[model samples]
Target: MSKNNSPDSIIRDITREFNTIVDSVSEESNFIHDRYFRFAFADPIRMAELLTLFSRRNASLKAFLDTIDLSSLRGARENHSTDKHIGSADLVFEVDLKNGGTTGLYVGIIAEHKSDKDKLVLNQISEYYHHLFLERKKDVPVIAFIVYNGEKDWNPLTETHFADYPEFYHDIGYPFKAIYLDVGHAIDDSEMKSLSPITLVALTAMKYICAKAQYTAPRSYRQVHLPLRLSA
Candidate 1:
């Protein structure tokens, strides 16, 4: 498919229904800063790459990433259901633990997304965590992976954001936090010669929230780019 920037145009849904649907795609950038984010990281391979990216940035996460049984990943889920009601997660990941004991047996990554500086909902993430726990009736370890695509002054939610102490707080030796993605840094380094092409693609997509307006597939600068331009 040609790279185009018609946010109004309806793109084909690749999975589920596979029938060309309209208005179901993430096009508008108002209510939600990121519309196409789910599409980008929904794949487990891409998700693994993202986690690997995290490991590269934060050394502590490397150990956590190592514990994840990526081969045992069941796949990514969206809008996962609870026993009584529905609570949607931007992306949900299920993976087994590698030689995990006690709380590390089976794990889940509840990836909540953001493009603006929205704080974590009071109990939304925890609620999902509890729901997943009840379903299995086991001590399931879960990670709240918050992928913030906004370039503005954004940070992880503080302990005050929760009604009570989070389950994983003391276990992880910190307030409940997210596996964060700094989108701006990704875009800035996207042009680096040292990075891989796939990394550039991931970086570019990560910037969709911050630079979506200026991001266009430019064959050139303009008709008067001191000597270059892109024409249809």
Candidate 2:
């Protein structure tokens, strides 16, 4: 196959195209951020690549990703109910996994983009789990990814706690754990170089907006040209 037609090459091409779209947009708002994340990760291949790259440091997550059938990756409809106070996740995905040829094991991935510190972040994730549980009518495993691009050094899992429940901390256990990715730190991480072009560009743009500082692409991403063209 020609070099341009290789899998990695194709990914790069798509990444550039997406970047162009992002560059076309002028104003930045929560709606824009949500749309950008949903549009960028809607593609199963891109979603799989992102999960694999970010989950590498975590053994459990890495193992889970390994079992996922990439072909079976797809966006899942969000479930919402005002009566139950359940809210939708920024992005939800379902992927099938191989389990010794047993009945298919489907996993739910919840991606939440946080550009600021929210003390209620855990509660937000819990709502997602609750909604999914009700929708599936079964105990399905979920992996919540909190993608943070804010300037503050925040770790919800460590910094936040249930309200008035210090005594119940030991009694309470959540069915899902969150994987936090701080974009500022991620940009400096050498491992970021391994990320697909689209993922890298998205992170770079987020950091720029959140920091409100002069935007300079990391050296590794310079090949793609700094200040990548974005579109609405």
Assess the local accuracy of residue 197 in candidate 1 as a C-alpha lDDT between 0 and 100: 28
Q: At residue 71, what lDDT does model 1 achieve?
A: 68
C-alpha lDDT of all candidate models, in order = 0.51, 0.64
Q: Candidates' TM-scores?
A: 0.60, 0.70
Using lDDT as the measure, the top candidate is: 2
lDDT of 1 at 165: 66
TM-score of 2: 0.70
> What's the alpha carbon RMSD for model 1?
8.7
lDDT of the structure predicted as candidate 2 = 0.64
**Steric clash count of candidate 2:** 8
Pairs in steric clash, model 1: none
